[model samples]
Target: MTRNATSFPFDIVLFDLDGTLVDSNRDLAPAVNHALSLEDRPPVPEAEVRNLIGGGAFAMLERALQATGGPVAQTRFAELGAELLAHYRAHIADNTVPFEGVTAALDRLAQLGCKLAVCTNKAEEPARDLLAKLDLAGRFDAIYGGDTLGPGNAKPDPAMLYAAIADCGGGRAAMVGDSTYDVRAARNANIPAITFRYGYHDVPVEELGGDAMIDHWNELLPTLEGVLTS
Candidate 1:
């Protein structure tokens, strides 16, 4: 087989799992709400959960508390976080679907010889399972889970981003994700990052400081084409 670097401007197109590829947050919101309810807290809205996402479980939980103006307690939060993860695991694949044009976009990238991978703050089991369910499993050469290696492998840190680069064979690579966490990870890893306009982020897309900002998944194709062919 030919090397991925030859034909694609980026050898690998690494994605952020939650908002970028799949709507896993629908399942996540309910689990979080259930956890909150268990703690006698008010139910959280999905919009709140959407905004709280992208930083993995710990970051998400901390942000969720801040969003609701609830004092964050680490010990209590850990227990509640476990409950949320349990609930989330039970319904992980339910209601999860690939974003519009994702398959087609990936198809074009593959046809153009771009290797694909996933770097998600999601847990490995569910992240890997969701991709398999969406038939996007084989599409990626690797999946970097938040808990896969250890505590700090999650997004906004760049560890997983660097890992993905290594997994894709260590040449030209690009990170494509929807959140500021994703963009930050890419920038920290010293890889070019591209942000999707429509994905969740605490900061504005432009403020995330990605190499490029794209509003649609289909744009990935032409953008990548320009990268390699330029």
Candidate 2:
């Protein structure tokens, strides 16, 4: 793939997992449906499930419940959460695969001496499991999940992004993601953010307020450099 020869500008490139690095909607959507099925609720369509993602599995399931009908039964929320997680863990990568050009882009970034890491709302173990399955686990200097820093530490909170930067030895950092959660996290952390246009964004990618936007992984380096300089 073509690439920019400009010098790298950031110390770290932190990526959001689902919809950003990998397309796991096939598996994720099913997991949501499975949880709903257990509660005898009608299965939400996969297209709708994509929008419900990004806030983590609990949020996805909660949204599914709400989108299908009404408020989730508080008594079964935890049980359904556990069930969803278990189902997802068992079929983590059934249809999941890295987005086009992801590996090549990662290699290019690594060659530029940019530390790579992941900060995602997916729970840590499943995130690790999926990456390992795709052989991309070794690519990240650090991998942080929603549960990594305990409650409320996930993206949109900035804790995970901060942790990813710190884990990668700290320097200039920028975030890449496909949703508001990622951009909000980067903004809250006072860092630049780049949004991927092809991911599962619930709204217009422009509204996410990224420092820059990339429609393909091959554009990542140039976009990151542009974000840094601007």
Candidate 3:
């Protein structure tokens, strides 16, 4: 298919915020532990919390509740979310770090004139704060989180992905994320999705059926190379 006049031959890139860009659980892990501790529920492992992150704060909490074999009470979940949010809000940047080579990849995309933005399942305030804290806030033309877009929607729905593409101002764009949610979101939007090997999918990478997969952030440049060159 011919590229659209305004469509990117490789112009716009929409990135997932969690496992794709930064490991956010330094805030997430301790916050969950604190809340569970308050209820006498055993603390969730940091690794599990890390795996649980891409879906959003409440989703992670729900997973934790299941892990603990609880009644899945909303009141308890709300209590936990409040505590976790309080702590996480205070230390948003403490343990956050960009994946190796992320800056270099983004810099290359920038130099190539690829418009960039972040579309994340994380809520708006935290997604924006994390971007600013990581110093990656300026790279994207737009940012969208679950709360920022309005109620009752998120990834796998394509609304957030389309919003980012529109904000970047007319270009073919792809979704980069760690889970099936990303793939489904991209398909729903009629855009392509790329899965990262390093992120938090509960299943193995090959099962994802994305346009491409990468184990390292730097591989992106050459992956794009293969596409634009071919």
The most accurate candidate by TM-score is 2
lDDT tens per residue, model 1, 157-196: 8888788777877767788888878878887887777777
- Per-model TM-score on C-alpha atoms: 0.90, 0.93, 0.91
Task: State residue 95's C-alpha deviation in candidate 2, in Å.
Answer: 0.8
Best by lDDT: 2
Q: Which stretches of candidate 3 lie over 4 Å from their true place?
A: 1-8, 227-230
**Candidate 3 residue-pair clash tally:** 1
Whole-structure CA lDDT of model 2? 0.87
lDDT of 1 at 67: 61
Tens-digit lDDT track for model 2 on 45-160?
88778888878888888888888887666879999999998999999999999999999999888888888999999889889999999999999999999999999898899988
Ranking by TM-score: 2, 3, 1
Worst 10 residues of 2 by lDDT: 1-10
lDDT tens readout by residue for model 3, 1-230: 32343333576788888888887776788987887788788988888787666568778777777787664567867878888788888888999898899999998787777888888888988889989988999888899997777876688778988888877776667677888878888889988777789887745667877788989997887776575336
Model 3 weakest 10-residue run by lDDT: 1-10
TM-score of 3: 0.91
